[model samples]
Target: MQITTNPEGRTILVGKAIFTPDEVNQGFEQVYKDNVSRVKIPGFRPGKAPFKIFASHVGIESMKEDFTEIAARQALKEMLSGKTIRVVGNPTFEVDSFDGPLNLTIKVSFIPDYELSDPSKITIAVPKFDVTDADLNKAIDNIRGRYASMAPVDRKAKKGDFVYFKWSVITDGRASDRKKEELVEIGMEDFVKDFDKNLVGVKSGDIKIVMAEISSGQEPVEIEINIGEIKERILPNLDDDFAKTLHVENVEALKDIVKNELLEQAKDAKEEYIESMIAKALLEKTNIELPENLIESSVDDEIEKLARDLSKKNITLEMYLEKRGINEEQLRAELTPKATNQAKLDVILDDYSKENSIEASEEEVDQEIEAISNAMKDARRPALNENDEQVRKNLARIIKRRKTVGYLMGKVQLTEK
Candidate 1:
């Protein structure tokens, strides 16, 4: 057997496998042995037929196709053995010649080999945010919303008012089924179509009809609103009393604390922005070559993920597409570019990790798992065991990627603006 590889592109490989006459003869014998018992030979029982008779009965020339497959498999095994190429899928085989040397051509996808331009030479601009007094004020305002008091008001409900009411689907001319109390923050129903518009002028004990579109991609539903209580939110004045309630010294001390928090958030946001810009720059700088079948396979995985995500919401991909007025082809077209880019990035990061000998330590995995367990303690979710194979693998992948990103951050030139 002889093998020769020719790259059609950086990633797509076209190779040829040629079996010698002796090897071809051996392949025929193997095929005959494997299939002889499965076929009906006229003069003898299933496995009792001689090779020449079996070949004559089955058309000896046609057996070349079966032999080609056997040769192709052996060729691929020998050709790819000990090679570090990340094959995307099984190589496809094409018979080159059945009569001479039993030749075959094989094709497979490998993640592209790429070179990165000097990271130090690449300039990336990262946006920086300065925490101002206005930002502090906004932060304080958000904190105020937490301690806000809602008191029933006699006037007509207005914007920013809380409308505590019961609503039911009006079937025919009467209310149908049960009514549930809904506390809606008026003036924020843009997500619910015209819900707030219909309730803004209503007073306590005043009934109204609202057509609400609760979820996007769905038609509006008509419901009869039974107004119960209309209340206005009262935010406590920023004073020593408010500070004491929050376990702080005084208003000045509270302002200092909140201002410091805003500053820290701004700093964190700046770091995040820098990291994101660095990643974008790295991808653009490297501009890795992506294989078509790799892109296609990635898109397929994305589609499967889309289906799973929809299933979690009690919806199906078919339903989502129908509601969106699109087909699977159109959805695939939309997802193709994103999937392609992600696959390319994964390839580059994997290659970079290998070249740099970068890896995630067991300590990092343990810490990540501990953080996950702590985060989910409130939900009472199943505990994650760090020693679990899949858990460790997934966490290690994420951690190594972050570490790789950090390494690239050190390699690049970041300008904050």
Candidate 2:
């Protein structure tokens, strides 16, 4: 067998496997034998039918098709064995003139070449915040608001007020007919971009129209928003009673708890920002030629995982294809870039782990297992035994990855927020 690759541009790779008559004949004999074992003739029982007789009965063309398919599958596997080829989807196979040399063409899609920079040199400014008395008070109010009850207000909506409104979003000049009613609090950064800004000074009887940009097809889309009604937030009074409701002794104790929570949140956010910065810097600093085969394989795996997840939700892959308005080829094309990025991140993280000598000890592994067991117990699930070697080994890997991330964050300069 002879193999050659033809680049079809746009990341599509065509691998042609040309088989000689000897190879084809061998495959044909195997196919005939395999079929003859299960098939029966009028006067002959299974496995007793001669190849010549079976070929005469089944027709040469039909037999050739079956044999060729099997041969192609085997040949393709052999051809791809040692190559780092990332196949975006299932290969499209074409047998060009089987009567000749049994030439087969297989098309594989994948992401083309791209380079990522090192993380150390990439500079990013992280927002820093100092925990102050006002900040602590604000955090306590936020906590209270989580458990706050809303009452029907007779006034207009204002800044720092929660508004429940019905609205429709126009995406790419096409207005959505579905009515989206969400409870949005003004001044909350968690709300979608420009949402809170549009809600300010709006009344219950008024309908406000606002425009915002949202992600659409690889670009930002200007969306027109139509607001229905707005209602002001009715926060619970922060007092001794509120503290008692939160299981705290008094307002002072509640404030302390809120402050500590805020500090922890700030620390986590700072660490996350630093990690992101480091990843960016490292990618910029290092230049590695990615294995194309790996990216394609990862994309295929991602697609299969997506299909399985959708299946669990009682949706078929066809349903997803229809919803996305894309064919299998288009879907694969879209996933190629995503898969490449994920592969790059994985490679970088793995390299970083090895370079830093990151490892989890037996005690750490045991602790992780215990933690998981406790969590499962709390969630009313079966507890995993600490002595289970497989479970411990798996937990050890997880703990090691977590510790590596923590260590990397600590290595970076973090401005506390």
Top model by lDDT, which number? 1
If scored against the real structure, what TM-score would every candidate get? 0.72, 0.61
lDDT of 2 by residue, 66-145 (tens): 97788678767875788675555566788887885688888776545444443343455687755888888777777877
Error of 1 at 177 (Å): 17
In candidate 2, which residue ranges exceed 4 Å CA deviation?
4-15, 73-92, 106-126, 146-157, 160-242, 282-340, 350-373, 376-417
Compute the lDDT for candidate 2.
0.73
* Model 1 local distance difference test score: 0.84
- lDDT of each residue in 106-161, candidate 1, tens digit only: 89887765686676787877775888788989899889989999898999888999
- lDDT of each prediction vs. the true structure? 0.84, 0.73
